[model samples]
Target: MPRSQAETPENETNSHAQKALSLDPWEAAYLRFETPEEEIQKFIGRLNRLGAPQWPRDAEIVELFCGRGNGLIALQRLGFTRIEGVDLSPRLLAQFKGSAKCTVADCRRLPFTDRSKDILIVQGGLHHLPALPGDLDQTFSEMQRALRKDGRVMFVEPWRTPFLTFVHLISEIPAVRRISRKMDAFASMTEYEIRTYEQWLGQPELIKKIARAHFVPVHEHVGWGKWNFVGTPR
Candidate 1:
């Protein structure tokens, strides 16, 4: 997969390249690996912390890298109506069973017009990008461009905390993994994208710094092996 260039035009050529980059391992196993109810609960908690409950039901919202649309489902359950999703994998997007429009597009080059979206959300997706600061920075730039001046961005991604380290250590134990379905699934997922996962894990602070540079922080939480962030465009 090519490293995503900043402000790449949302054209047919770019779209094809982006789709080629979408050869994600999770695309094949995500449905089998995740428990939808549990995933939705996690998304609900994150969205609530981002003040989703206070937002109007008709607010325009888009979720990038929305694998299988669990986050979209959470937004729907919260009463959000004008919701949309974007991901590179068509197969994963096909699994989405919601009213929101789903598009196959690269996060680094969003299809939306400037200042057109009210809110942008990403859950457990950034860490999948192979390129660290570059791809991540490009994605953030695209996000800022696509969002309205007052638009908000929310994300929850894996963090390299002590608790996460401990979980990783224990997850290595076959017996422990067998006893915990969540752990087993997590282990399997991480193993599938270990290279990119480890790249993100080693630089949690850098990731936060990049995000902070793009948006002014409104809320931030780093714990439980996750970095939850909410911000408005700078």
Candidate 2:
């Protein structure tokens, strides 16, 4: 049976997620790898879908929780200029490459002024938020507040489908409880699990509804244990 709106997971929390040594512990994980080329193309396609004459090369963009700015490297190649990364750790920001400014800050509370940004991209970052509806909801509102008129937003979040969810639980058990949460086991696991809260696992519909509520959703794509959204800020 398909999950009804009422069946959407809510108030889900895991004590283990809070036990992370660094909230954004991606410093070690993304410190070395380049963003997947396929993903870069996917994002570039979505961005190109937005502006008319041609994809605006001068768009002021930021990637929230951008660990080491690896994804920004890919975005730069896609014709985006004035790209910046906002992260919480200076250590992670230090690893960033490409010609981009890096800011150490919280995603929920951005440092930009109202309507200061042309685009906001949260690539593989939303799932790390505190696993509560309120927390997710606030993050959405903050993203909305940061956008200029006609500004677009895109999020590439981890998805949790049933089999993937099971894989995620197994991975989380070993990675967080047993292995000290210092590495990315999901990268090593062949299973399609996305390391995120139960509410988000395999729940693309819920993710769509959440984004649509805060903005006018332009497109949504889900597959490979990931959910991607492109939207116009409302």
Highest TM-score against the true fold, candidate: 1
Query: Which pairs of residues collide in model 1?
Result: none
Model 1 spans > 4 angstroms off: 1-25
Candidate 1 contains a number of clashing pairs equal to 0
Task: Kindly give the stretch of ten consecutive residues in candidate 1 with the minimal lDDT sum.
Answer: 23-32
RMSD of 1: 10.6
List the global CA lDDT of all models: 0.87, 0.68
For model 2, the superposed segments whose C-alpha errors exceed 4 Å read 1-26, 30-54, 162-184, 187-196, 202-206
Q: Write the per-residue lDDT of candidate 2 for residues 81-181, one digit (tens) a residue.
A: 78999988776676565788889998888898888998888877777665646667888888899899889888877675565556555655653635543
Model 1, 5-26: lDDT tens per residue? Answer: 7545666678656654564655
Deviation of model 1 at 144, angstroms:
0.2
Most lDDT-accurate candidate: 1
**TM per prediction:** 0.86, 0.69
